[model samples]
Target: MNRSHELQLLSLEMQNELFRILDFWSKKAIDSEFGGFVGRINAAGEVVPKASKGAVLNTRLLWTFSATYRKTSNELYRTMADRAYDYLLDYFWDKEDGGLFWECDYQGKPINTRKQAYGQGFGVYAFSEYFLATGNKESLAYARELFALLEEKYRDPEFEGYIEALSADWQLMEDMRLSPKDANSPKSMNTHLHILEPYTNLYRAWPNEKLKERILVLIKLFQKRIIDPKTGHFNLFFDRNWTVQSEIVSYGHDIEGAWLLHEAALETDETEVIQSVRQSALKLVEVTSNEGTDTDGSVWYEKEGDQIDKDRHWWVQAEAMVGLMDAWEITNDDWYFQGLQKAWEYIRANLLDTQNGEWFWSVDDQGNPNAKEDKVGFWKCPYHNSRALIELISRINKLKI
Candidate 1:
C-alpha cells in the first residue's frame, strides 16, 4: 500500500483504540461512590477502592476528556471533563496552599499534601484545555493561578530552571521523588519536560510577556543542559546547581522532549531559538533512533548500571510516534515517516490490550506484555497513547492542508 493509504488505515485503528479506552475507563474506572476517577486499577483490571488518588492521574484524565471532547465534539466527553474538573476543584486544589496536592485519599481528601511542581504544571495543562473547550472563565482563571504559583514558587531566579518539589505551603522539599523508580535528584529532566509541555499549552491560551519569557528560557535550558550534544539522550538527574549527577539515559524522555522542546520553541516564534531547537530535536530523533529503537520499531526503556530493562513502555511508544513525525517534518525524511508508521504497528500489535480495553503498562523485551503493572493507576492513563493519536491526526492534517 501507498504511504497515505497506510497512514489512513493506522489512523482509523488509532481512533478506535482511543475511543475504546475512553469508553471502557469511563464506564468502569470512574468512582461513582467518590467524586473523581478511582486511583488504582490493578493489573487484572480491578479497581482498588482504598488506593489513594494522585493529582497526576486526575489531571491527566481531565486533559484526556477535554481533548477528546474538543476533537470529537461529543457532549458525553464534555461531561467527563466536567466531572474531572469538579473533582479537581473540590479535592486536588489547595485553596490555602495555592497549588495542587501530590496525593489524595480514596475519598478525595488530600493526605500527602506536598505541592509538586509537576502536578501544578499538569493542573495548568488540564484546566487550560477545559477552559478552551467550555469557555469557562473560572477554568481560565484557575489555569492562570496555577501558572502564577509555578512561577512564584518553582522558578529559580538564580538557577533558571524550576525547582522539583515543595511542601504543602510551597517550601522546598529534600526528598523529591516523583516515584520509586525515579532517582531522588534535586532536578529531573521529567519535571522540566512537563514544565515545558504545560507552558506551551498555557501560552496558547494566556500569552503574557512573563509566560513567554519564561518559556523561552525553558526552551534554551533544555537545549543547553538537559540534552547531551555528544549522545542525544537526555541526562536523567541533576543537582540544584545545574550539575549533572548521573549519566543515565532515558530513551523515552529523550524522544518525548525532542518534539516537546520543538513545540515550545515554535510557540515562541523566535527564529534563532527555533533553528537551534529544531537542530537539537532532529538530532535527538536520529541518535535515539539508532540506539533505543528496536527492529520491531518500538522504543526501549533506559539502562541503569549495566542493566537494560528492555521493556517497551507505553509512553515511550506514544512519544516515539510524535518524535519520528517531528523528525520527518524537520528533515522531510522518508525514514522518519516509516519509523512513525512502524512504531504505531508495534504498539497496536503488542502494547494495546485488545482483550481488556486500555493499554498494558509495558511489554517485555521479547514482546510479551508484563501483567504485573496496573492497567490504570497513578502512572497509567489514556493521556500518552491517546494524545499521540490526537497529535498525529492534527500534524498529518496540517501537512495535507
Candidate 2:
C-alpha cells in the first residue's frame, strides 16, 4: 500500500479502537449505586464496587469522555463527561479544604484526603477539557481554581519544581510518595511531568499570563532538573534541593514526557524554548527507542542498572506508539514510523484483551498477559491508550503522506 493508504488504514483502526474503549468504559465501568465510575474492575470484567475511588481515575475519566465528546459531538460521550464532572465536584472535590482529595470511599465520601500534586494536575486537565467541550464557564472556573491551588499550595519557592504531596490542610507531608511503588521523596519526575501536561492543556483553554509563565518554567525543569542531559532519561526521584535520588528508568514516562514537553513548548509559542525543547524531545525519543524497546516492538516497563524489566506494560506500549508517531512527524523519518507500526502490532497482538473489554495491565516478556493487576484502578485508566488513539488519528489525518 502507498503511504497515504497506510495512514488511512491506521486512522480507521485507531478510530474504531477509540470508540471501543469509550463503549467499554461507558457500559461496564459505571457504578450505579454509587456516584462516578467504580474504583476497580478485574481483568475478567467484574466490577469491584467496594474499591476505594481514586482522584486520578475519576479525573482521567472526565478527560477521556470530555475529549471524546469534543471530537465526536456524541451526546452519549457528553453524558459520560457530565457524569464524571458531577461526581468529581460532588465527591472528589474537598469543599472544606479546597483542591481535590486523593481518594474517596466507594460511597463517594472522602477517604484519603491528602492532596497529591499529580492528582491535582489531572483535575485541571479534566476540567479544562470539560470546559472546552461544553463551553461551561463553571468548568473553566474550576480549572482555574485548581491551577491557582497548585501554584499557591504545591509550588516550592525555595526550590524550582512542585512538591509531591500535602496534608488535607495543604501542609507539606513527611511521606510524599504518590504510591507504594514510588520512592518516598520530596519531588518526583512523574508528578512534575503530569503537572506540565495539564498546565499545557489548561493554558490552551485559559492562556493567562501566570499559566504561561508556569508552563515555561515546567518546560525548563524538564530540560534541566528532571531529565539527565547526558543520558536523556529522566531522573525518577529527587530531593527538595533537586538532588537525584533514584536510578530507575521508566520507558513510558520518558516517551510520554518527550511529546508532552514538545507540546508545552509549542503552546508557549516561545521560539527559543521551542527550539531547545524540540531537540531535547528528539533525544529522549531516540534513547527510549534504542534502549527501551524489545525486538517485538513492545516497550519494557522500566530498568534499574542491568536488571531490565522486560514486561510490556499497556500504558508504555500506548505511549510508545504516540511518541514514535510524534517523532515521525517531527523528523519525517521512516524509522520512527516503522517503530510506531511495530508498537501498534505489539499492542494488538499481546496487550489488548480481545476476549475481555479494555487492555491488560501488562504482558510478560514471553507475551503472557498478567492477570493480577486491576483492569481499571487508581493507576489504570482509559487516558493513555484512548488519548494515544485520539492523537494518532489526528496526527495521521494531518499528514500529507
Best by lDDT: 2
**Can you give the TM-score per candidate against the true fold?**
0.97, 0.99
lDDT of 2 by residue, 5-83 (tens): 9899999998998998888999989899887899999878888759999999999999999998998899999999999
For each candidate in turn, give its C-alpha RMSD to the true structure in angstroms.
1.2, 0.8
Best by TM-score: 2
What does the lDDT come to for candidate 2? 0.91
Q: Model 2 misses residue 326 by how many Å?
A: 0.9
What does candidate 1 score on TM? 0.97
- In candidate 1, which residue pairs clash? none
Q: Candidate 1: where is the Cα deviation over 4 Å?
A: none
* Cα lDDT, model 1, residue 120: 91
